[model samples]
Target: MTEARSNIAPVLRYAAMRRIRSFEERVGELFLRGQSAGSMLHLSIGEEAVVGMTDAMAPGDTFTTHHRGHGVFLARGADPARMMAEIAGKESGYCRGKGGSMHIADRALGHLGANAIVGGGIPHVVGAGLTYRNRRSGQISVAFFGDGAMSQGILYESMNMAALWHLPVIFCCINNQYGMGTRVDRSAGKLGFGGRAEAFGLIAAHAEGQEVEAVHHAARDLVAAARDGRPGFLEIDAYRFYGHARMDKSPYRSPEEEAEGRARDPLTTARARLAAEGLADAADLDRIDAAAAVEMDAALEADVAAAPPGLPTMFQDVYAPGTPAPRPQADRLRAVLSEAPR
Candidate 1:
């Protein structure tokens, strides 16, 4: 625990983790209050350290994340207000509220997007890697997937291509132990995920995801290799304290198992270590947490008051303007508009 403090500034790492935890907790509260756009919500509550590795990434490096990605995006400096608005389905959101919880994307922040499908975003980083290489951008692309995605054939195919072509890509598998309700052991035949990437001729590493410094060191080395045109794989061992989705209670997991997972929460561990080492007092950490709460609460209020996208704008981003709409659809839209009181 003290080792991480030495590897990186404890204040910086702890602050980021606390902010992510606070942001996700507030989102959950807003969702339960029926302020969010969609009923489906996923949180990266116990896996803050998994995203803490991004501290090692350069600004030019891009990343694609899985559904439970608010922490990852937040760590990369995505505006909390806009992210909240997106979750609330406000027109002011990143994708004009269209992407919602599962598909938030901000190209300017180097966040390609968060994919809903288990393995949907894996290949995207490969494509970005190809683009970076072709442009000689000296940038790397990272793909963050879960243990569940390890079973998906698309992941393997993407890894093979990355290795064969020497693409600057890092395949980061956050092995949170459970994919939905099924434990990883029951799902993946092999416990070691790095071997899967090594089989495809890529440098592979396994690290403790709960320790921020451990993940950061591993990520830094892997990213350096990737920049040199060597693809790599990293499997970070962490656990999701909550169920897969917002409404799920994880009845499949025993009470003892759930308790055990919570005990190892990275936020709690980080705070304890910081306090013990005299790096930061409880008061300092609490102040950061309080500020995060205030920021997120205001964002939630604004998002709830924001307007939803108008029907006329449905196909605006989908297709180029001036393209003729289908006759039947155009007529229906006109009819609906005419019947409105306005």
Candidate 2:
């Protein structure tokens, strides 16, 4: 039992790191290979600690993720095969390939979903918390968003409501230094992201998001408070190694900025911490890496052989049960008629 318990953290950390690295790298390659389609990809490199922190939370606890959510979904135990298939636009994806990288969901795992619209998932997580409270359930809901999302009004509104209602919610802000081309300093008036939560009377904590142990400890404490019916906030000071999206040249940031960010790679930091603390040896970490590589390779191969969804099934899941079919011609005429005003 002691050995099993000791090995769990290292394995989980390695898996989260591996999945994020492999998924992002492969997605980029696939995009360059002309196999991927949709909105530009925002790879979450150098910020694996946030996902590692989520791995320590309760299994039933739910969370809403941002555009850079592949790590979160994997840390929450989402199947890599399906996730890769989804990114590859295969039929076996989480949303039957309809929702790609930014919109993956696994209801059973309590991943409500990841949203492409910045700050879109904030209110949804609040709704989930309200559902838990109304049902008298003990589960906690988490909202994960980037520092740029701090500018949005819905985030503040959600915080106000969560604090007032004493909802079991945790708002995790991954302050990755920039929101697209704009730096945090350029966009947010307050430099400290966590302090922004205090106005709503929510208990907030900030930590070194590049360090897995630090992030895990902070998350565990906040999640404990949340489960006790207190809303909390955590601001993880992390960085992303990639641009906001594939099309972005990141001209706003310099080579020096990228170098500074790369120096604190989360995967390396986590492995070193585990070794220094005697929780795991280098060999154990290597074995985990090897296993992760194998899994990722298999997933990629399967994704390559997969086919896109059929065109006939495009509108299959658009409506609720017994809803009438949408009339395109009538809708177009109604728009013209309404504009003409009789």
Candidate 3:
């Protein structure tokens, strides 16, 4: 798929944001309809500009994501139908129904994986960056985590290692404010996440996730620096318009707060920006949104109808090739009974 690249042409960026917004909305609907694999869907509805980072990245750059990675993967060229299938736990999904929404990954797309652990995936990019540096490949790696991970010691360690080794890696913090039910301000005493990166001698930038163009520009420069063996950090601060998970209604947050957060909708902001700039008129923007909606609607239907992985294949990918597969628990029980009778 063609990309927005360094400049992030306004029309293409708007279209990509539209697709992510539509796809996320469809995911929410899927959960509501009880078609999702689990009750653990984390939507990236309001944080569409985080996907803009993909626009700055070139082919072969690798990335790892936190739980709310659906938008990023989609922007990086994941098939929406397959993504929905994965979220639905269907056989045709990216991980063959094994990895649902939070864990979906495609190595072919340079996505190492989406990890559920707070800062679990950050270190992997450091290792990848080390490999790239040793090979002089000029390729970079990225670790996409959340503000919650700001408190994780592993993140600091990983950042230090990346800087110390002069590895080409980027630590991208998608700071959507809330960590679970708690607000970020309530947790971290010292803010300015970018300031912490400076202590480690890494280039860092912060951008509002609502501004698609601004995010793309920040990411583009960071990508260039990372390719040149300068590890960097980017904090895309946005607001989470929903709860931590699909099941969470977030009683902790007042209705007014949610309203205020929703008002900062990145898609709405980008659409108006595009129109105001004459990059896309209302009709063109509507067409883009309509196309996205159609694409996701079809994807939803396909995923809803897609078959689940057969029970017999449960352990298919669990072990090394040629390793003895574990017998079904029922079969094991029967064998034990037979031996006892003898």
Model 3, 1-342: lDDT tens per residue? 123223337778888888988898899999999999989899987888886688899899999999999989999999999999999999999999998988999999999999899999999999999899999998999999899999999999999999999999999999999899989989899997999999998999999888978888999999999999999999998999889998899999999999988888788888788766666677877888899999999999999999999988797878887998877899999889988955
Q: Is candidate 2 or candidate 3 better by lDDT?
A: 3
Off by over 4 Å in 2: 1-7, 327-342
Error of 3 at 235 (Å): 0.5
Which of the numbered candidates is closest to the native, going by highest lDDT? 3
lDDT of each candidate versus the true structure: 0.87, 0.82, 0.90
Ranking by lDDT: 3, 1, 2
- Per residue, candidate 2 scores C-alpha lDDT tens digits across 228-290 of 778899888898788898877788899999999988888888877777767767887787777
> What is the C-alpha lDDT profile of model 1 across 32-60, one tens digit per residue?
89898877789998888975568878897
- Runs in model 1 deviating more than 4 A are 1-8, 322-342
Clashing pairs in 1: none
